[model samples]
Target: MRAFLLLLFVFLTLGAAPARAQQPTPTRVIEALYDQLSAYQLRRYQPDSGYQLLTLPSTFSGPELAALRLRERQLVRVDLVYSAYRFDPKFSQRQLNIDRLRNLDERLPGLLMDPSITWNLIEQTGCTTPDECQQYFHGFVLYIEKRYTKADTKAEIGRLTARLNATEKKIERIRAVRKSPGKPLACGYPHVEDKLRKLTKRIKKAYDCTQKDRRPRTVTFQAEVSRQGKVLNVRLPAVDSAGAAAPPCPEELTGAIAEGLAFTDGFLLGKQRLPFTVTGRLSLPLRPQQGFKVTGYYLADSLMRKYRVKLLRDGCQARQLRPGDATEEDPIPNPDPNVVTRVLERHPDWQKQTVVADVTGSMYPYTADLLIWLQLAAAGPEKTFVFFNDGDDLPDKQKRLGQTGGLYDARTNDYGRIRQRVIEAMGAGGGGDAPENDCEALLRAHQLAPEAQDIILVADNHTFPRDTKLLEGTRLPVKIILCGVTDHINPKYLALARRYGYSLHTLDTDLTNLSELPDNQITIIEGVRYQTTPGGFRRVSGRAE
Candidate 1:
């Protein structure tokens, strides 16, 4: 039993030893290092290599193991030192420290050491994602060395320079692929160049065929390009291009070409082709038209009936009523002075008379009363009444023209009161000092009272050079009766009256009684009569007499 027990124990011990020896020691060490490195990578501060040294397998022995442990320790030291330096490489004394670290192999005393051993340890760490690991490792080293290094520090630079260059080359390759011609086929499409060529040929053919004669014409057509770069349907909207106002070939051709060029094989596999319609306009030079130059005119009889004046070959002539014979009371058979004098002699009682008044500034109250008299005259007398001076109704200078000086007369009629007001207004100088422009005032009054038959200006004739157009159209006879102070009348005012066919009557200072003037002259139109037949006959006729 003792021998069996001893043998069993030996067998068990030997079996276990072989199994342990066959185990993946290197893999376990590497995994343990990876875990430690991962922890260091994730930390805010770099970890010391002394702690990583514990991960080595106990079976690892002698110089090889020592060298491996030493190399790992140096790597860990490098990581921590790089991390610390990278944090703030600008710190003073950092340059001296980095130079000392870089010369580690030379500075170390008698221990077989290589500065590159630390770098090789990092590279051999078996990173599953090596690129990312290398980036972090190289970036930490570069960042640490940058502050102390000059611009020419290429030797001290990290592996990041090479990695960055490799990344840039990869990007260039991708861009080249994107720009490559016919690469659209990678997305399953036909070459755009091929479709464009076919479309150009078809368009040229259609254009030539549709516009055979070259006469101006319009055409309209519908077309569709298939996803396979084929022209599917091309037809005119009309039966042919002949009936079209403009040709459709150009637009149809353009649309077909565009659709073809835009076609892709990707569209061909799906539903890419779409129907498109086009229209075209063609123009040709046109000849000018030669037509009649029609004109219009006023017919002879039509113009004769419409206008009182007649159009002669040279100019217009007035239509006149011819007198059959002369009679005794035929006043002024002609407008001629001799005819007028002869008519006046035939009717001895016939007389041309005028009544005038002033109505400027303070004379307005007197003028209102005078208007009543004038209205009466207008209603009864056959003669005309004339007024002078700016009335109260004149624009821009309108004002009351009379005052009684705090006196009143209840028994006075309108005319009586007016006469009194006139006397008072005249005593006040009647606006003689009120910037009176006699010529402009008369011309303005003539325009305002255009319906009046005769004018009897009573101003002091203070201003001259009146506008003459106011009297140019007066057909009814006019008269001027000067009132108020003498020496106020000028030849210009008299000439204005004569210009408008008026007879002047001067009521020079001595006229105290107003009734001395003819009643017919003071009153308005009362009656008028004319014989229908000319003969030596007895007749008496009257209207509104």
Candidate 2:
């Protein structure tokens, strides 16, 4: 295998059936602006206290009108692209950029929003999905093109002509008094008509292409590059509805390139090889039946036996199971053959099982499996459930201050209602910022179901438990029913688990008998297989064997 293959992942087949690729729609830009930043335009440009980059600035006699119009459109284009792109998690340095925009400095990380720059910043970032970033950029520009119809263009041309006549009359009056036409005015206005004519032609061409090219055939990869320009490593990552994952870089396709596929500078940012991260897609002409082991990427990352060193965290407080860490009692045979069902079976004597879940947008997608979990594992009268949103649901929750605040809008009880709440929240669609109030929910669940012996915290791996302070007083050992966990386990979560004696349990959604699962429910980072342990993913049997 090439060293790049070591990085991880294989080709991702984004769609099925024969059709052109999807086109970008500009309206999404408007929608995102209102959704994230709470920004909405009341009407088209007019003189107002609010900022409007495209406000009709002045009547133009010649080229300046062309210059101003071009500048305004460029800024508008930047505004539209950035507004949409910011929503993507990979676009980091987000908080800093958002802070600036919310404060009214029309600048983005790359573009200053200055009229002087035409914004070549349209360059795309490399990623696991090939050409996705650049393709989106093309879609955005075309969206802008399609948004302005031919009627709208004609109207603008007529309006500019009117402005030109007025300006020309004023210039004639001024010139009559000036015998000494000292320095010739460096007005670029004379070029406006030609410039606009060319612009309209270009926009029409792009619009036509947008109509013709529904999708582009391409692939994207993400890698850590060294100063030497060598591929230090590459791996495809994914996100769990419960949290997030690195983007997918399909392996079967990647491995197809073998040891030495050199991506041109198109994949790299700038000419310099200084250590940095790069993610991009390249167009590839691949044929069907080209499949290899697309599942290995996940297998290697999530199921690999590599573990943390013996000692863990501040003052060596965390403990790893010694090699001989088996209980003296013969292992409790799992009643449910399903890999995930064995999680609750960890403590056989426990009569009642209590599940405390982070039932948010991410968890909602797994509703089918969730129903399976409830029906199969949590169905008995001995089982009780507690559900809540982030910290806001609990009164004692502390605020993170500058970072994300708890968005706990949910609070419910009973086994029956729990399912409905999770589905509703999932459909309603606000996962909130990264950190959830999982701590408070856990704390509350403990109080309500104090008698339940085995407490399972159904955690979304992306969000960390912020209520460690409450856990400080927790007497009962909590077994984490880790939901949506994939290839990479957050070391911090493991550290906390070590400190609290919480043994982690994840699902193997691929159980032959339980194949009703939708794609989102199986949260592994990449595709991998786990050994059939007596209880969950407790050990790794060489996957190859």
Candidate 3:
């Protein structure tokens, strides 16, 4: 069946589909490959020949005899390339492998040598298994090393020196410019309310009052702000330390002060996210002789937010922080639901169940509970999880807009990891109309994992799936566990259950031990579908299971 779909995809992509002149999308083309291939094979794609052909303009011919023949040949050449990629899947895979190495080399020039954590494998490899990706990455590293010699390193160093010289010259020129009584104002300082509060809080916890103070009691610094409010320089007053060891002020605390200042509106030249180095003074009131200049970099606002008090404290005794006070920014603002409690209300047999869930912020509470339950339940090792963002879909008169979320395999046996990595990333933020991409996600999940018999979907009950075609097809009986919503159940979900012989289950996380709750708006009795309009549940057209 998948083979057939791949062939049809090839035909359509080659501009060979009858009556459908429009070209196939990259997503659909990939989906076709997914339909026929194993997960390992998913990484492979035609780098040189296949992708080029797929991107070529469709064939066109006119009345001129010579020109018409030429056009036909051009079309055939391109179609043949497309055919090779589609028909012989191995060719495409080879292309993808070649492309991957080249891409890695181009993007991260010194990837193997540079042990920086900047290389994000998941984003780079597009969600491949960790082992497969690492294997490929290491191979590419070796390939790069074989050619990168001492001469190459020397040449790179020379280039860096030249760039540095040029930068220094530019800085001199900028500094040479005559200034007014005050530095040029970039603009009104942008509000740094959050950053300012955080900096103050960090400064207050310089020492653990409960424990004997080991380090500096006070640190003071002066900052030079750029036109755009970035911290260009930080300097401490020359301390009157009589040639002795300075008070040890933590670098982390001063660094936050610099960044918090940078985030504020300075001169406001042109807005930019940039780095600046600053030096500040350290002081200890108890030991006046211990004081010195400290130097550090001002971090980008976003990067600064991630600096944790716990980690920064390092070996220092932790100052007792206020219980309610937050040391870290709240995870994408939304109501926090205890997913574990909700999942416990009706403990699930996790074995043999493929979990499909909506992770949108609105659904986070319910989704969180589901994940907590998954963590607690000693489920089968076989279960696969799939997550998707609800994106735009079309219907008759009404249009669902702003829906653009991609599907990612967010499944893991380690439920602990899910809570930390996946759940923490979920925010009440997304695009697309009020409705989500549940239909598309389910369809994709179904295609990805055909073996899992029982499909359990954690869905938002507020909106229905616009793509009804997914329901029209042959499918497993789904258990649509409606979460975060109850009064309303999108009729389409019911339609899905009705069409595919699945059952509907709604959980009011607030209520205990509830099961299989019905929608308040629409009621189904026997085999009839009825919607509440001005009147109530008058039998609608479709059959209700």
322-404 per-residue lDDT for model 1 (tens digits): 33422222221221212122322333342323334444432332243343332222233343332333322233123222211
Give the Cα error of residue 540 in candidate 3, in Å: 10
Compose the digit string of candidate 2's lDDT tens values, residues 108-219: 2222222112111121233235344334322112101112233443444344335434544554444453322222211110111223234334323322332433343444
Least accurate stretch of 10 residues (summed lDDT) in model 3?
114-123
What local distance difference test score does each model get?
A: 0.31, 0.36, 0.40
- Which lDDT tens digits does candidate 3 get at residues 362-404? 4544654565345434544645676654431222123232234
- Lowest-lDDT window of 10 residues in candidate 1? 530-539
> What lDDT is obtained when candidate 2 is compared to the true structure?
0.36
Best by TM-score: 3
Q: By lDDT, highest first, what's the ranking?
A: 3, 2, 1
Over 4 Å off in model 2, which ranges?
1-342, 345-352, 365-367, 377-379, 391-415, 421-429, 508-545
Worst 10 residues of 2 by lDDT: 291-300
CA lDDT, candidate 1, residue 522: 20
Position 293, candidate 1: lDDT = 11
By lDDT, the best candidate is: 3
lDDT of 1 at 123: 18
Q: Predict model 1's lDDT versus the native.
A: 0.31
